[model samples]
Target: MPDLQLLCLSNPLLDIQAVGNEELLQKYGLKANAAILAEEQHMGLYDDLIQNYHAEVIAGGGSNIARGAQYMLPPNSVFFIGCISNDKYGRLLKKSCEKAGVRTEFRIDENVPTGRCGVVITGHNRSLCTSLAAANEYKVEHLKDPDVWKLVQDTKIYYVEGYHLTVCVPAVLALAEEAVTTDKVFIFNFSAPFIPQVYGSPLAIVLEYADYIIGNETEAMAWAESQSQSTKSIAEIARLLIRLPKKNKKRYRIVIITQGEAPTISAVAKSGGEIEITEHPVRKVPSDLIKDTNGAGDAWAGGFCAGLVQGKTLYECIDMGHWLAQLGIQELGAAYPYPRRTFQPSKD
Candidate 1:
């Protein structure tokens, strides 16, 4: 593959999604619009989804963002790295990436089976229950491979989802340090609230090296609480995140927080202890048009990174994020609509 502009590190999972009711979610003790790792009790949920409901299997997790971005970017510009078992689901994952035009470097784990996520959709909300089997086997040594490290060096942007922290904090920290040293853009996503609440120490270490931090309001608040800023509002937390001590001082940190149906809030760090904050209202989609809300955040991040790759302004990047998010919500899974729509960056 040629030198890639965007590189992503995440826990890849084959997602089995189905339209379920509130009772189903309650039976599994899952809250709507939340992401959680599946425990022993939830092991049967996947089979239940497949047999009891109308299930749709799709590529999910970091792959969702990678595919979304690859759909907008030039061919071979995006590369993804993750661990997976050489099993049927893993084969499906590789094939899906190939179909989407995203190059991948997957570390094979013989001992563990491929990971899977059960997405139970209730109305427009989705509750995720993930089983991180092979994904949890990713090691720093995999990234140390000459071939993989070279891709890291060639990339302009490095993105990692928070869920990877539980599996390999060392890998994430190493990439963060590399981003600072190479003066590359490092984007971090707070994929779920448990990441900051449960994995605070490692998350803090990696966060200082992040040039961009993206998350929803619930995640932002959890992060604030982890940092002992529990009373801060979302905008204040965004500013605080930007002001966190950073390893890369060449560029100021940027924080973006998305609130469902509310304005997206952003804060950019500036010189002399200043912070620039702005809110971009979301484009309204008719309630009846929403098919699923599973990958809205990933879609937004994908669009934002695609904008960055195209050298668009920050505002334009946010606009692209919103545009992709709107389109993604209309689909049944974490997927964008087919026959891609061309997006023009706003001049105003």
Candidate 2:
């Protein structure tokens, strides 16, 4: 087996999740099933919910869950880069991820509170109100720390979360360029609609170095618009991404666009001018069984990357993505409720 190490740069968060009804959503001006950044003032509201409503505190953030896919990914193979306050929540976040076998590379910010989110879930409805706080404090300087730089130099694959674009686009671009010069695989995700919709130019430059890309329907649509293309057809969007000019001639280009409860669209470009774009159906979650969807896409990205680390075929890789996503929607927070159960490659 190939020795695998993935370095992820993401916003680290500690999540407090609870079950609440539409009444609470209306009271707080929260849109059901949507995630929006919140101000520090909102932390008190989340605290109230947790204190009075029995919310569970779990490790949260794109980087946290990407590493949390310890069930699918190799143990201790993921190194996460992010910032958190040197406080109790920070310790909780680190311990939670470590318990799942993910090695954390955190930049402790003493001046700010740890990043956190309040996830409110109702019947088939969920909403997130996040306080970026210390998470947003991570800057290019942190990446330059000798210890962090060493990991950057030693990594084989770079797994990036698009949210980092808003936090530090220059840092992300620099990492992409490094991946190109060093011949390391660069995997990028269109994390949310806001990223591609708002920061097009920088993201485009970063994608030039990406060997693999992952996006959901909304993100894909947003990215299509960012490229000045029509978003009416998802197939066209997939092809556009797959055909994106690559900086590394030896790297294979791959793109996947996922739709909740529907077939996944993918495009792959082989070295000899062979290109195939097709749809792969996902295993459906019965409507009654979905607990929360907060981390499904992140889980998919992690699982798919895990397959790549182990040299699995394209089809098998996507299957792992879907399977992990399905598992995610059945749980509450970013990291699943338990770490004992893990992914088993399909015999098929």
Candidate 3:
């Protein structure tokens, strides 16, 4: 395989997405377009979707972002590590990543079944209810393996999802420490708003080492509130995020906050305690053409990371991120169109 440039650690879930009616949403107490962790009442939701709805399984979570980066980067440039069950769904997830040219090092568990997310679609709105299952079985021992650690050493950039904090914080910290030690790039995403709200302690520790912190407006606000900055605006939150303590002083921090259908706020820390902030407007897509919003954020990270790996400027990276997110929403799931749309950077 080609040398790994980007390494991603997150829960690899098999997304079972299908359209449903109001009764289905009401049955699970799920709000339209909202994402939540699965509860006891959601136990049979996956089976019900398969048996009742026309469910389509897709590689989700970090796999979605890995595939997005692989779509833009050369083959084998992006590598993903996650825990999976020794089952058909796990095999399917592996096949999906391989098909997209993203390499994987999955830890297989014989006991639990593969993790899955049921994406209940109500027209353009999608409600995500995720059951971690075997994905939560990830152990730091897997990262300690000689071969795996070598992969980590070989990688130059690390992208970790906040959802993984629920699964393994030590493993994420280990990677973060390695990045800091090597002066490499480390990007952290607040995958969901609940992450910081519920796991504030671990989130605080990890944020100190993150060079690039990414999140949506909700997640950003949640983090701000958790950090006792609830009164701050989005741009203010970005500034605060970059000014957090850092172990590696060689690289300054950059905070990026995405607002759905609005402008994205980015803050960069400069020498002499200066913070530069800018807002990039979203590329508008007609409401009639929109499909699902499930993997839009993942697509954005994929595009942004791929651009970063290619030495693109921050503006170009954000543009590429928006491009991929736009492409993903036009599809039924968090996926891009086949035959790939070429992205040419603007001169102006």
Candidate 4:
């Protein structure tokens, strides 16, 4: 197995999650299942909701993925690149990363405020409102340092979040180009479904640079647009993504499409100029109940990256992703409490 060093570049935020009943929603005037951007006027409403419910705040987004990878992979094998302010939330984020055993290569800006995401969970569903504050200030210039470049070069895989593509296009493109030149694997998470609707063209450009692409069924349908209906099968979506032309045909090897509570389909490009689709049924754990769905995708990405770093086959990587996702939904946050296990080929 190749020694794996995974580098992730994206936004890191402190997530404040409040779980409540219908009364709590009524107090805040928050519509169920909708993410509303709260203004200063709504601060009191949020505070009241927090005080009414059992609330928990933790590190979220790309940092969550870094934390998950740290828990699943060998020590010092995972590194995160992002920006945060010298605020209390920023300090908390750093402490969380250290506790999870993830290396932090963060740029601290004293002028900008740290980023945050307010997650409201009502039963099985949840909504997120994000402020990309300090994260938006992260530019290509911050990554120009020799040490940062060296980390990129030493890494076997580079993971990117699609949410950062629009704001940090130049930086994302530069890193993707470097990954291509260095023959390092590049994995992309499509992130929220609404992102591609706004930055489809830039996202399309970024997708061309990815070695492997991962997304939920809703995100895939949104990206596919008029080509397929929303109810299309996961396999159909994965196949469509694989057929799409990229910069180098041989470079884009696999595309995995995940459907919640359904089998995940792995679409692989063959050397014989054919595309093959395989389905891996997720192992259902009967007692598992989903408390929050926020970090499920990030957890899946971490598991997939862990497999790839260990030189596991594409099928094995997909299976690892499914397994981790199962563990993630059982908890309130993305990082699940599971013992770290080195990848063994037989487990594939």
Candidate 5:
């Protein structure tokens, strides 16, 4: 139980990235910078890209953030649960997670094929088309295995992307329930604008258990809009998020919001019931250093979770998150390069 620092449940998918132009994007029916669920027939385009366009494939999903944190923390610190096919792609995903230092507890669906994400990198942005073949089939039943619950019991901190709500809110509720019952830390993020806009019901269920809520300016704004309070300022929104009632009344929660190169805002609940609002600015990345913005939010979530488990202060946690995102955005995918980032917090 002492070995695991974080536990996460996600819908795993393989990422096949290729460089393309806007025309190629339209040809595939994908919008820039959004992850869309593709139809079964859409896989033919992935075949086309692999055969001609020099596609790079790897394990990718919002859960990759936990995998990213494994690189920063000690070995076997992070564990993931997802559904994958009982096929070669499933094997590849397992191998990739191991290589990234993330332990996995996957349910193999023999009837379905492993999922895939066809990423089209058009200059500065990526349009993602995902086929959730086996991933969408993932259910709460998969985690019912006693062995999986053992890992969940060993965990002290849990981090999961908001997207999990769409797949299995019950599973998210299970993890959230653990966070509350055990008085452990549960870190959650609003993965995309659509999640708060469309899946607010499940999001609300998960929020009742979150100790830390992470989101970008757009997601935060969208969430505020969903609450019918669209006009709130960023600081105001974050403050409101932290003040939201939690299922566990004794919990001290916080909300962190990032704005690309702008100052990141954190609303902390003080020991004496004072709500302390802090702003931590980000370093501007040079155009050449900016690789892709695909996983910046996830990377931030991972770094912050790692910091939380290591018992760092809120300010330190924010700096560590920014540092990891800095390293990640310089790479091609959501992952850090071989010379992985050193777990050091930069001055705010």
Candidate 6:
């Protein structure tokens, strides 16, 4: 399994998701169609509105993906790096990680509260309003420990979330730099559409350091624009990104761009002089079968990373990613029925 060890660096927050019809939206004083960012004053109003609908509190964001991978992969192979406050939510986040068998190396911040996202879902569409809270308090100093550096050094791959690029640029860059120095395969997710807009420069720098890149259609579009291109398809976007020059092209070998329900394009730098492009068809899923769209991208990344860690070919990785994504969409939140691992862990 290529001696896999993953260091996932991102936020660990609670997601309060509300699912129902338009009447529920009206009850919360929210616009019937769009997602509105709610303040503290709106909490009371939201509480009163959600009384009529189904509300679910779950562990969310990159942490959820880390948890998924931990359960799906071999025991003690996954570790999560982020910051959470020493509050009630923080305690829950820790328990969630432990339950999923993910080791937590989170910094507890006293100044800020635990991070959270208030998600409102109407039919298949959903909106998120996040309060970074303690997640934003993470700094480069948190990654300075020698033990943490060794974890990055020994790891085969580093999976980072693009959302962290917006709130904790310095910390994110620090980890990326260490991953580069240690010669680890750096896999990054582009995350939300708004992330590239807010952290463009830092994200560009991080991309330069990345060995593998994964993103959805909207995030791919935003990243392509940042690269000064006008491509709309994920395949085109992946081609453009792979062709972009880097200082050490030999080390940065693969770029896989996923277009939801469409074929994924993979670009690989060869041992010889050629750059190869391979298109793999996605496994079809019913259009009306989706229960929750949240964390689908993250779940895909986790599946792709699992394949990579298992020494699967690029096509096999894409196939595994599609299968995992299908599993993710079938559930109400991320980390649904735990996935079965294809490879077993060794005692050595």
Give the lDDT of residue 225 in candidate 3.
Answer: 89
Q: 118-195, model 1: which lDDT tens digit per residue? A: 998886688999998998899999998998898889898999999999889989988998999989999999999999
RMSD values, in order shown: 2.6, 2.5, 2.0, 3.2, 2.1, 4.3
The lDDT values for all models are: 0.88, 0.80, 0.89, 0.75, 0.83, 0.72
Full ranking by lDDT: 3, 1, 5, 2, 4, 6
Candidate 1: 10-residue stretch with minimal lDDT: 339-348
Name model 5 segments beyond 4 Å from true. 21-35
Q: Which tens-of-lDDT digit does each residue in 1-348 have in candidate 5? A: 249888877779888789877777777777777777788657776776777789887788855787777877988898988899988778888888988878899988899888888888877777888888888777887776798888888888888778777788888888888788888888888988999999988888788788899999999999999999957599999888887878876778899999988899999876876888888987567888889877888888888888887889888888888888888888888778776657765654
Q: Rank the candidates by TM-score, best first.
A: 3, 5, 2, 1, 4, 6
Cand. 6 Cα-lDDT: 0.72
Q: Give the TM-score of each candidate.
A: 0.91, 0.91, 0.93, 0.88, 0.93, 0.86
Candidates 2 and 6 compared by TM-score, better number = 2
Clashing pairs in 4: none
1-348 per-residue lDDT for model 2 (tens digits): 223377888889888888888777877788888878885446575767777779888778866545645566667877788889999889988887777777788888899988888888886777889888889888788888888888788877888888998788877877888888899888898888988888887788888888988899899998888878876688888778888888988888888888877788988887677778888888778878787676888878878887877678888888888878877788776555464566655544
Clashes in candidate 3: how many? 0
After the best TM-score superposition of candidate 5, give how far the Cα of residue 154 lies from its true spot, in angstroms: 0.8
Off by over 4 Å in 6: 1-4, 20-24, 32-36, 44-54, 122-127, 247-250, 271-273, 338-348
Task: Give the C-alpha lDDT of model 2.
Answer: 0.80
Q: Mark the regions of model 1 whose C-alpha exceeds 4 Å error after superposition.
A: 19-36, 39-54, 121-127, 345-348
Which one wins by TM-score: 2 or 3? 3
Per-residue lDDT of 27 in model 6: 54
